[model samples]
Target chain A: MDLKDKLVSSFMAFEDGIDVNDPVHDIRSEAIKNFETKGFPSKKEEAWKYTSLNNLQKIDFSVFPKQESALEYKDIKKYFLHEIDTYKIVFVDGIYSSYLSETTHDGVDVCLMSSALTKPMYRQIIELYFNKIAKKEDSLTSLNTAFSKEGAYIYIPKNKAPRKPIQILHLATGNEASLMLQPRNLIIAEENAEVQVIERHQSLTSNEVFTNSVTEIFAAKDARVDYYKLQNDNANASLIDNTYIDQKDNSVVRVHTFSFGGKLTRNNLNYYQNGERIDSTLKGITILDGKQHVDHYTLVHHAQPNCESHQDYKGIYDGSSTGVFNGKILVDKIAQKTDAFQQNNNVLISDKATLNTKPQLEIFADDVKCSHGCTIGQLDEDALFYLQSRGIPKKEAGALLMYAFANNVLESVRIPELKARVNKLIANKLGVRLGFEL
Target chain B: MLKINDLHAGIEGKKILKGINLEVKPGEVHAIMGPNGSGKSTLASVIAGKEEFEIKKGNIELDGEDIEEMAPEERSHNGIFLSFQYPVEIPGVSVTNFIKTAINESRKAQGLEDMPANEMLKKIREKAELLEIDRKFLSRSLNEGFSGGEKKRNEIFQMAMLEPKLAILDETDSGLDIDALRIVANGVNKLRGSDNAIIVITHYQRLLDYIVPDFVHVLHDGKIVKSGGKELALELEEKGYDWVKQETVA
Candidate 1:
């Protein structure tokens, strides 16, 4: 059978086994319908021209099996439990592990979306905004919606700002062959409320796995949200993550994506300013080596007047690896006085390594300022010689200079704990020990 | 303590230093006066082991050992220092850190242990004060955003810190105000000793008035044309380089 027929057959088999009479099941069925109409995008599509997913469609992977083995709290504590005081939520194999999660804030509400679907108020909000901002035309988003069985739901009440950040850890563990995991998350910060959200994705086993996840963030008027995504999967894993952000009038949003591991991964981040005087900042750093392929696609849209957006992404590719970056800025006709800037830079260590960067700006309004540029080259030789002349070995000198180059992006990360963890991961990928001494 | 025998060097297949010879003994200061493109800086760089120039035929010795085949860092470890005409600016690296690393590396090459941090800091402050360099300059990035005079002074400050056996100041007096020239000359004079030698390469006699050389050499067209006492410098200052070039051609 063809690929579409096989996918249809697999969906039919999944529907007959799982319960489908609830509201969540109804949403899943509608998402499947959307997937059937959209299908998977090909190279002919403008957005998917540089990044081709034909290899993903050719794999025959099974849906993640139910994890029945009881996991001890202490065994998984190392992944989520840190010294910082914050609200924590843990998901094992794409399903919420209630026994391993905790939250203590009074004005905040955190619960599993599957259980939260039973409440009318929660259902009303999800129906209003969930999956509304993200494009269903893309197969990845459609696939994530079709397999959105177990995910997290976070809500901050209007005008009430929580004191601590909310942490979500997506832990994937399965002994089966080629497990496919999909994690869906929805976060909404009401008007005038402030929140910090941290998302981490990790794998327990070294087997071949595929993780397709989607996260949607909505910041209401006068609200502020700091969102961080940390992806450190096993070397034998692949992932496709999509993040959609929407900000209203006078709201501020900052998103930091740190990608250090994965055999093949793609992250699509889009931010939309739908109200006046909104500000958004998107920063990311990807460290890869040894045949790894990491692609980052970002889009910033200014639909209202007097909005500002800034985007910067930097990467270090070494050892016969490859990286692709495509960033776009779109200013609509009504987006007068819009200010947008984008830059992408890469450092290639090996002669055989490659980087394909395309920075674009589309401005329809006459009274707007937009600019984009990209740079791809090796490290500065003068800088290297200066460091080596100071007794640092050639390798250590190269690594130290690379660290300083990548630190420019890391310095924008506001959370101390998350920043430190990301730095450790970057050091590991670059094969350089951190200079931290007690 | 340093010797150059028939040194000849060039860049890009063009010969610049052609069959030049000089000897710098301990407790002596030598001034090399030459016209423009007369290979004064070439001699200094060839001795310091800069790799860009090709040594067509020459042998450079540091303390009776052949140093033409040594690396720049190796030569530095062997106590041969060159104050470049245009010192490079290394951003984001502090002066103290750069000097300390150089000192530790040299010491290690001599099979000695690293110096204590407190002792090193104390010595740096003392030497900096002697050179009239502000203490805050040590914390700034090495030579970055420094004025020409400041850059020249920093070079002397580094020479003081490294304490090399043979110091070659290549055009160190150029681009310096009168006051800065006095300060740099004072610093160099204080660092002189009976066990070390100094080579001052310049084109003018204004600097010779401050740091008098024991022997003066007139270099023209890739070779030292004349050798005499310190009075030769004053005569050259009176006649100018055009007279020397005409006399050499004659």
Candidate 2:
């Protein structure tokens, strides 16, 4: 069977393990119906014009794995931000991994979504927040919701901050010939609370692995949240990440995505400013080579006055890699004094590489500042020649120039260790050892 | 130390340097004087192995070896340097790091190990001091947000750090004030020796007064119209390049 039909058929057995009378079950059933009504997105859709899921849908991905897999910490340690200590909520093959995880329950809840869904004390919070901000009409998100049994669940209470950052890790071991996973994560930061999170999806082997993941973040009044998504998987792996964030009054939230590897990856990040003076920042740096492809579709809905949003994304495409960036900003009629800025810049290093970038804006408020800029160009030959003239080889010169092109967006990374790790990855991807630290 | 035998080169289809011939020996300084569009910079770039210009005819030899097919880095490795008239700005790369990489790459090409960190730092300090460059300035991105004078000085600093065998200063004095010009010329004078050669390509003879050349050649229409001693530069500055143009035409 095809992937979609297989998923539709597996929903029946999927519900047998969970409580059938729970309210979330009804939501899950409704989501499956939605996914069944609208299958995978096609090239004909306006948003999916540059990125097609037709080929992915043709692959007969196994919706459920037969057994849980175990992995050693020393083997997959590089995939994590191991330089720093943090609370880790890890999963392997759609099942939670206790041996490889270090969860917390001191002042905040840094644990599993299965616990949050099944436990009695956390049902109220689950009922209020789960799938509330995630788009129900979007077929991919609904599909993830239909199979959202396991993932990270983090919550920080009022006027408190976690002792350290949180890490939500998903590992896909080569337990099956080809595997598919859907992990849903929910994070809530209450009033005046703050937290930082780093999320990554890694495949251990070269086997085919497809992950459809969704995350919903709620930042309450005066709350601060920083979320990071690191997508660097093997060539046989693919990921569709759907993340939604809701910001209340005076809350600050920023999401940084670093996409360096994968055969095919799509990031759909949305932000809704529900209160005044909220701040939302989204930044991404993507470097792809070989036959890799990455698409970033983002939205910022400014519904209240005195709010601000900033979006900056930079990409470097080499070999035959393709990239896309479609950013949309909407300002409601009453959102006066709203400041929203969007900028997407891309550099294509080869003639075979391609990029399609577009900015969409719908403004109804008269008193607001909204600006967007898009640029696509090759590496500056003059700059390369400059470095080459100084005795550096042409290849290393090109890598250095590309590094400078993508270095500005990295300055805003608050985590020093993560930034260093990313720098090393970029250098490795460009196949050069920079003479100096970034 | 350097020889150009009836060299002809150009960019695209248009010829820029036509039948240019010159020779420079060790311990000698040759100044190529010309007006704008007279192909002085083209000769410098050609000698430094800029691929934009095609060498249509003849050859450029360094220490008796033909280098027409060599890449820019290869030419740099063979002890040739060109101080650009308009230096490119590369942000996020500090000056110290850029020079360190350049030096290490050149050393690696020559099959030598990386210079010891202390020795490298000491050399950088000595060269930067020769150019009167601030220590803090060496930490900034290479020429980013720098003034025109600073860019020119940075080029001279690179030349000093590399200590090339044949250094070609292409209009290095164009953007500098008298103070900066004096400092830059002083730096070049300090680096000069009997084993190296200097070719100063400039429009104004004012720079020649600071670093006096042994021979001066008037270039017009892509060819060297006249060759003489250091007095020729002062004469051209007095009579202007129109004198050379008219004399060539006559």
Mind giving the per-residue lDDT tens digits that candidate 2 earns over A329-437? 9999999999999999999888999999999999999999999999999888777767878899898888888888887788778899988888888889998976665
What TM-scores result for chain A when each predicted structure is judged separately against the true chain A? 0.93, 0.98
What would the per-residue lDDT of candidate 2 be over residues B88-170, giving only the tens digit for each residue?
88877789989998999999899998888999999999999999999999999898999988999999999999989999999
Off by over 4 Å in 2: A436-438
Question: Highest TM-score: which candidate?
Answer: 2
Ten-residue segment with the worst summed lDDT in candidate 1 chain B? B88-97
Give the interface-residue alpha carbon RMSD of model 1.
Answer: 4.5
Clashing residue pairs in candidate 2, if any? none
Once fitted onto the true fold, the runs of candidate 1 whose alpha carbons sit more than 4 angstroms away are: A1-27, A44-46, A56-60, A68-86, A98-100, A110-121, A417-428, A432-438, B1-53, B63-250
How many residue pairs in model 1 have overlapping backbones? Answer: 0
Cα-based RMSD of the predictions, in order? 4.4, 1.9
Superposed by TM-score, candidate 1 places the C-alpha of residue A76 at a distance from the truth, in angstroms, of: 6.9
True-structure lDDT of candidate 1: 0.80
The true-versus-predicted C-alpha distance at residue A7 of model 1, in Å, is: 5.2
